[model samples]
Target: MAAEMTVSELVRRARDGQARALGRLISLVEDGSPRLAEVAAELAPHTGGAQVVGLTGPPGVGKSTSTSALVKALRASGRRVGVLAVDPSSPFSGGALLGDRVRMQEHATDDGVFIRSMATRGHLGGLAWSTPQALRVLDAAGFDIVLIETVGVGQSEVDVVSLADTTLVLLAPGMGDGIQAAKAGILEVADVFVVNKADREGADQTVRELKYMISLGRREKGPSWRTPIVRTVAARSEGVDELVQAVTDHRDWLIEHGELDARRVQRAENEIQAVVAARLRAEMGELRGGATLAGLAREIVDGRSDPYRAAEQLLADLRS
Candidate 1:
């Protein structure tokens, strides 16, 4: 724990391309280390400047290809981009294959583009526990745009909504039942929708269905943002420019309505609460000891006590 490293030294080392320093800073934030709060307080002012975009969709929707294309386009326009591809950890092995990184190899040597693969680490909310910390590191490192590509596990992926400045949901043609399965939460959180593999049959129908769903859920003055369905063949780099323009338009709209700052405030509040919850759980576990908690859990499961009552008793015991 290099707790003595000053913010300036950390920032300088991060800028000098020290991956370990960057990783450590992110780890501190994710683990809710005391120093993380101090570092975040110092770095908060530097955030809200980078455009954080989140991309999520069903598996095999070509999200990585689209992300790569978008990153390339941003770089061509002289913008530095950072990409965080969140992959699900294999339950059997407890490791991530990181297939997204493999797909994004085109930019491997580009200093302007920094790409990192993160595991969801069994977090239930469709986001990696370390995601917020990673984004902060990217912001501090002076990236103009930070793109977060999710694990693409359907509805749980809504966590990205609270974390990103703009959330683009990617869908492909011929999804059939998969589209219906994701319609409830995934459809509502998206600020922009991309229909990748547009050259395939049923692309237009997918777009129309998505638009109808959006229209049905529309509320006057409720977020008041139109979610546009842009077609793209990301593998071939088709419609990449239009997709970029749509993202820009949505971001500009956010800026115009003052929602950008409001959203940032909400995200900060969420981060603080998450950190608090995590810390409380850790401290409580340490105080109780793992064996005690395990015994309590077993007792509850055996119907010795109801879960809610057992929780109350534990709380009372802790307070005492």
Candidate 2:
């Protein structure tokens, strides 16, 4: 804990390329400290520049491997990279279970790469509760690219798409993931389909199935930027450059079509809503001392008021 540094100092040092300062800032957000507003103020002007890319898929799809491969490619091109690997929280401890730094030890010594594994902490959709704020930290730190890898919690993990400019849905061969991916509603959100472990026997089948499935649907995006499927054996770092190139192409497309700003605006909107919701929850807890929501629940339970009416009364009270 960098407890000695004030919020302003942390923001200044982080923007100056101090990794420790940036790490502390992210921790502050994860812990939901009151100083978060100050941190946000410091970061607001510097954000929305980093290209956020989201990678998600079923378990065993090699999302971490692909992320590491992409980091290598990005670093080789002199781009500073930030990787956020969201891992499941331990039930008792609330700590990240799978330490992503271990898998990405290859970049451990690279000053150009910063990787952090965040605990999902019972948050659903395979994202950390503090992911948006943590991303703002990385963006304000002047990273050229940010790679977000989800907790691999199956289909409901599309929340990453809201925050990323380009979302990669990865599938491994022979896992029945192709059908599951479609069932998970992942087919619609993927800007890029990554077939990992491409050297495996079912790789061609996976790619073919995805292409066929993609052909059956029409994108609402105007001007026709067809999503590309990139094949990679991430363990060997093969096809990573092509994947990176595909991401670059998508970023360029977003910029040209003015979708980048649109996405960022949506991202900020989501963040603000989350903040307001959390604050309301805190306020509701305080109101518990006065039997507000509890009183409403009792009224509903005793048949004195319907749930909808009780909810309306609670909203009226909150506004008052």
Which parts of model 1 are misplaced by more than 4 Å? 1-7, 16-20, 27-35, 89-104, 122-128, 154-156, 177-184, 219-223
lDDT against the true structure, per candidate, is 0.75, 0.81
Estimate, for each residue in 37-104, the C-alpha lDDT of model 1 and write its tens digit. Answer: 67677666666668999998877788888898899889988998988877654544534444644754
Tell me how far candidate 2 lies from the true structure as C-alpha RMSD in angstroms. 2.5
Report clash pairs, candidate 1.
none
RMSD values, in order shown: 3.1, 2.5
- Give the Å shift of residue 292 in candidate 1: 3.8
Best by lDDT: 2
